[model samples]
Target: MTDPLGAARIAIIGGGIVGIALARALTLRGLGEVTVFEKEHRLAAHQTGHNSGVVHAGLYYKPGSLKAELCALGRVAIREFCAEKKLPYREVGKLVVAIDESELPALAEIERRSIANGVPDLRRIDEVAELREIEPHVAGVAAVHSPQTAVVDYAAITEAMAQDVRAGGGSILLGQEVVAMTVEAGRVRVRTAVSEQVFDRVIACAGLQSDVVAKLVGADPSPKILPFRGEYWSLAPERNDLVNGMIYPVPDPRFPFLGVHFTRGVYDDIHVGPNAVPALAREGYRWLAISPKDTWESLTWPGAPSLAKQHWRMGVDEISASLLKTRWFRKARRFVPELRSRDLVAKTAAGVRAQAWGRDGALLDDFAVDQVGPVTLLRNAPSPAATSSMSIADYVIDHFLTVRAD
Candidate 1:
């Protein structure tokens, strides 16, 4: 059955999980004639592909927040989608461990938050023995175990979404970088590097370039995006038995980043230490992969100077860990005492998170979506954005799409 608005032309920028998910949803609903414009040749090339692929169980976010709501719902939705599509979905579970008495308060806070968020099968284990039973190699005085927290191949999911979009008569235009967008009359005119096209509605999910894209569409320039590079190190294949499931640290309440921890991938590969370091470039994976334009924009942002002054100590620590592999291993070794420097030998892929910051240097923690004329800009979607992609698509379509009374 075709929707009444099937004739409407919709354009989505960015080909990450969120963008692809939105495309799939709109096309499947027959809501519009949808087209996805991805700057990269392949989908999920940035944050989507580079993330740890953990389906969040709504632990850290405050109750009633978008992150809490979407993550709680999206995990179940994603599991169902993966099952229907015959994709890899592993419910190996996760343990948020507290190594000492000092971290127990934070762990308890997480437990409280998790319960309020209605996370399934969540339990707070007080005994070290119980923690050991859950994660054999993990050493912690207390732990909050979420049995339903799972992992999946999000890149595969993104590709599957693209396929779904194509099967539903939608087009995915790869390598088409959107330079500018103008709202003329009632339609949005999107100008890409290759060509110019007009869309009934344009949704930009540009990850690293989100702020830039939003500015291009005449949106407010506050809450500028600062790209923070997360560097991961793969555990040695021989030491695969270090942990059975995901082992995350009790995140510092002061900082937005969840500290360096362990994650078991869908393929049974273990990864450690995605320390948050300010990237010199938006797409900077390595220290040398610098972009002058990206650097200049970040350095000059009103929030950057204030942010630096506030979190200089934490920033310095992350930079040191990024430069020295030993420093990174030391951070991880706090939870898993047996995890040696040799275990953190292999360098895995790096991801740049587009974290939004206010003029006062405060980090924006919740989901941000706004409309400017005929265009909708997804300003900030960090960590669990991929986890909540399907739900987000639903939210966007329900709210952002304009009704044409014909």
Candidate 2:
């Protein structure tokens, strides 16, 4: 039988959730002969595996933006996918708490955004009694609760998507990194260490190395990636009672990162933290995992100076918290006043976020994509990327791939 997609070859760089999800979507639609190349031997080796596992409830994103639209659709798609696959999907809920009256305005803004984003079953709790009813140990002047915000294993989800890709006759190549690429006659010639192939189209969902991949396709490198490592601290099993579901702070409007928070995982293990700190390497999970080249590139980037000038105070505070357990503990204890110092027993594995920043020293707040000839580069996909993976795939296929194909 002839191939329905007319033997059109497609390549997806990166084995992360977004990449796998894209390949799965394409193959399911019989779009082309799909193949995914992952540099790591295992899928979800980076961002997909190392995350807080919280399914955001469209609470923090700007309404009408791609992040807002995709995240809203993606969560429902993820829930259904899990149900279909018999995977664990726990709607443990999430509460954004304001510890003082000073934070009420920011809290109100969050409530407004949540309502705008259409977060399901979102509630605004003004009275402390009502807040305490949801979380008895929580001390807050006001809070916004999203009962449908949930948690799941993203790595497992990626693997499940890979299965769908294979079942649909798509190929997933592990340990095959695309080292070079050249566009010729409206097609892309991709080269790896061991082999080379040409493709009708290529989409790079490369997370940490997204900018680097874009550079290979001769795309603009204005939005360089700045790796920020977020470290998590596991809460003591006995102290798990301090948090019912998830307790988050009113994030600073100046930055994109949500503040340090507590999350109760799908397995019922509670963890506190994910304090954001600048990582020395793209895949740096620890302070000691330093790469001289990566560090030099970041330090010498044009945006480095202005970015530092803008966020130096926050950088210092975050770094201090990362170094001092007491400082980290204090941040977590703000919402749950009953939290003791001993409640945080050990540190967990860290996850490095690939935050995209412009040459003007401004962090990109929404999901960003760029097109280079036949290549589509996902320049920036943070926070909700995992949550929005499937929807992102659908968006890419519907907007970029299918449009060009037509």
Candidate 3:
């Protein structure tokens, strides 16, 4: 007789917030066995641990998109999860400031999307006096205040979710890099550098390597993952009082990357930045952190040339900001006049965004997921993904997993 556990074994690749959340959700749904494979020695080592820690209010997504729906519902879910776990969740709010009359149209569009997305306690302030009441030191002709926007430690939340998985008898295998996958005999063989295992089914939330992992399972690779590095500068400790909560610019509607902004963490330390610049490698954090293979993969893609031709100006500006500290600080100073170059003295850890781009050069603007054989792939999940981790998990379980609780 064969082992019954083999019939019920389920594998999840990537040990970030999404994967751990999925593991816990599946275990709670009465799955007999679940295993999480993390290449890193610890979980949340990539995007989960490197983000600005803002719990998005679902204000910037398209009204009816998966990002909009999931982020709204997920924000509430995160609050509840934090409360239950005794984690810190601070409702410090957010202000999207429009510096001049030129930005009003974009700001108005954002407001429309926010309302349609059912964002609660969202208000518009056109008067500088009213804006002063919210962000006293800011300079903007108009602004949208999202009072429900909050912040939390996403890595901590991910760890807590992992605990739930462990408590529920699931296994988390660390430092296991998945190298290949072969689906046959109604089970998928998942291979790592050190070992190989056969699972009844697999779901990959591989983040930065999502495209590569999907390709291993025979998924289409039209939308290649392009790595964009977002580097941050920490505000001087004494200058932390410059901003209350988060202050953002009216983003360029044409692009997916949000402009440089100020964010106050749960620890009350403030950071300015995250300028979008092309990274030399997939996981590149510094300019010198280069990978010849990763660079070749990006440069050789059909979308790379077209995307460069389309947004070369913006790309140049982003690279300029990334290289020149003064240029970056000047952008942040537009909203907060008091912010000086000296205020942004400390360098914070940078994050590489795994942005998906089509062959025609359009940046994919929504959460993208698809199925290939016995594997379900979360191809693109950016920004509010941490806030929407639990919701995405529920979506995958309820829709993608055919082997559900009876």
Candidate 4:
């Protein structure tokens, strides 16, 4: 007879990037016997699959925030990990361009906070000539260069991390969606659609459905997950050279979406977009794709009234930009004069950001995780999360051990 638990002391829910990375971390620490549970047949099916693959350079986050601190650390850690794995990655650099005087102030703030966050060689270049020399196709009144930034296939990184997890004696069960979990006698009992498993500890990283998973483990589901659809438009192959690097617009402080811009991915595709719009479904990618449960919960939640009141104006603007293609492209054309309605050749993909809204209807501005018994729930991890997975995993490990000791 075999020991039924599949050789792991702990179970990692959701084989997304964070969970896969955590599984790898646990194995590397010689704390083996870890199992990854993924509902999807393969890894990187959702958020990791839809990522822009821009390895952020630690700019644009508030000074001393988790996003800022972890990004500075993650850039180095991810780059090194890529190298060790012989994966394709580049420190290709990035630029946040301010189209006019009004946006310059925010650009300046970004620069200051970036420095405060310890990003190296970050500087403002007002000279049009200098800007043209770096990326000839991009046109802006001024630009801020983030020389430390890079791009890679984030899905590949997730896959590599999964590989490392298995190599280190851990296992992953694909197509195993954890339908329910309960704590009994100081252990975790996880019920999947196909099977049931028990572990000494459980860590869930279900991205869009984080709130639902949290509730399944007996944690309060106060910070409701709000889905923001970020749609992208890939430029025609002929138009790629015009957008030479990651050309960004100065983001509006009131909104989390970094405004539609140009990104030159590691695959040599110059993509534009990520217009932030309210997603009708947690996984809605197109118009009319609505999830009744998600829609009802958000509208009826006590916290949503406050959140809507706070960002009602911004939400309206985002929706306008999303529905009106002309309005959205006009934003991209600010930095690239050559951009036209025809420049957008392909609907590359879109991502749904899991924004956490509190019961009072306020947005959660930081990373949040909750644990009950042997089950841990990840609530909110947006933006630099892909960049900060390693550090986040370390923090989770520390918390798990500390709680276990107690």
Candidate 5:
């Protein structure tokens, strides 16, 4: 069979998992001559490398949404990929606990969503004894358990995918930031500081700079990338017993964040946190890593007032926790009563999430994609993005690329 896209020239912006996954998908299928441009000197340098490494089990997402659908399919794909590459993949399981009766209603809603989303072996544990069976130190009135929730090294997975891309005849260029783009006559001419290339199609899976890249293609900027930094603290190795697998709080439905929680990483090291706080820069990983321009843009955005008005309380709480270890420790102790302040020894390298917010201050909850001429942009792909990379690649190709072999 002849490959219709074999003659096509394809350009992928961003060297994160999603971009690399798309390149691998296209090259493996003999779809096109694929080239990936990454601004960073290495792939997965940003979101892909900085995450908590959990392969979510479609528990919290709204049913029928892209997150729910892609996460389900993506989990299986990732497991298969890891098996194929002999990478470490551990089904550590996850427990979402409602600390008190007040949180029960919300926990029930999560249970409903989990069941509706077909979370495998999902069980609602109302008795404290039942919850103890899973996480012995957990303190909660009720909980929902997903035994299939797992963890893996996403950065390793991304590198493995890049290997496949190379094996399949694709090219990945590092430190090639796409500074400019021009879409005309059904082709996109992408330019970096050092080089320029024209392609039949360009797809940007740029995590943090998605909106900025979209602007290059003359797309809407309403869904602006609002970088929210999530900081974690490493658990003392001796205190790793505090968490059996992963213990989480029933997330506040009013916001998109999952709140501070504990995760036993794939390597059996436990870490706590990821409180959502506004980042001072697009790539701000630490509090001191500030950019005045990025700060000014967010403060002056049209939706600034509305967002502040709606989430100021949460903003204050999260910021407080970020600044003070005691506040964060209290939140973590709620899930595991045995968690001591001293147990959370050191703060880990933080991750900045590219949360998309509209002009009206509504944070986009579902995955968003936009098409500009032949350029396709992923505007909002947080949390499960690393998990959903391969599925997202298949989705974009099937729905947006609009090409098939003859």
Candidate 6:
């Protein structure tokens, strides 16, 4: 299956969920000679594997935008794909709760957007009794229940996609990281740790290392990727009863991440956490884990300074929460009062969101796609990416295919 002449139909850089989704999509569309390169020994080992597994219902994005459209479409597609594949999943739903009166406006906005995005089952409920009825221990004056929110093991979905790609005549190479990409004439030369590959079209789904890969081939990577490590803590076995399902806080409009809350995993475990703190490394995980070179580059970047200047207050608060585990548990306790400090335990698998920020310090609120030269780079695709993977594949392919599609 190696492209001996360096003439591949398409070459995907990463083997995460997004890359696998595209690989499958292209093959399904009858485009073979496709190859996916993975640095890891197996697929979905990074952000895809570490995600919270929430199949977003398109509640937070602008109604007519790509984020909304793709997620809405992708959610349905993913649900069907899971059902067809017999992958374990649950439409356990999620609650976007307004912990206080001031938060109600944000909750209302979420409801409005959800309705606008064709999420027909959104309902707002007031009265603590009702909130407690839905999730007995959760605290809130009101909540927006998105019945469409579901959970699944994304890694499983990615594995299924890789299998489909192989069955459909695409070859996926693992343990091979794309070191460089150079477009020569009409063909793209993709150099990896192991060998060189030639492709007509290349899709870089490098996730955390997307900027680096994109820059290797001459793309304006203005919006530098600032890896925000989202750390999580699963529930102590005794605290499993504290959460029935997903309980998300109303997201701050200024930020992209949904604050720390409760999510009952599809694997029969109820866990909470993911405090978004500025990560020292693009893939930073633990407390003392530091990459001085990356840290310096990230901190000294103009975009980083501007980004900090804009979101400094929120950044400090998130860092504080990360530094003090008690603060994280406190946020959870607000939702589920019975969730004590002891209920929190280290859950190592965490996703580092590839948060793309503009040079002007503006957070790219929606998914960003930039067409540079012959390559189409997926600049920013954060949460709900797994949910939106299929739709994004169509979108990406459709954009490129329509050029000569007349």
* lDDT for 244 (candidate 3): 89
- Runs in model 6 deviating more than 4 A are 1-8, 402-406
Q: Which pairs in model 4 have colliding backbones? A: 8-33, 303-359, 303-361, 307-361
Over 4 Å off, model 5: 1-6, 254-256, 403-406
**Candidate closest to the true structure, highest lDDT:** 2
lDDT of 2 by residue, 123-222 (tens): 9999999998888899888999999999999999999999999999999999999999999998999999987999999999999999999999889997
What are the Cα lDDT values of the candidates? 0.87, 0.91, 0.88, 0.82, 0.90, 0.82
lDDT score, candidate 3: 0.88
Error of 2 at 153 (Å): 0.3
For residue 40, what is the lDDT in candidate 6? 90
**Residues 236-344, model 5: lDDT tens digits:** 9987777899988998654536588888899898889788999999999999999999999999999999999998998899999999999999988888887888989
Q: Write the per-residue lDDT of candidate 1 for residues 30-86, one digit (tens) a residue.
A: 788899999988999999999888998888888899988988878888999999999
TM-score of 6: 0.95
List where candidate 3 sits over 4 angstroms from the true fold: 1-7, 254-256, 403-406
Cα lDDT tens digits for candidate 4, 168-209? 888899999989888878888889888887788788888888
* Clashing pairs counted in every model: 0, 0, 0, 4, 0, 0
Residue-by-residue lDDT tens digits, candidate 6, 237-283: 77788788899899875564658878889986877867788888887
Give me the runs in candidate 2 sitting further than 4 Å from their true place: 1-6, 254-256
Which pairs clash inside model 1? Answer: none
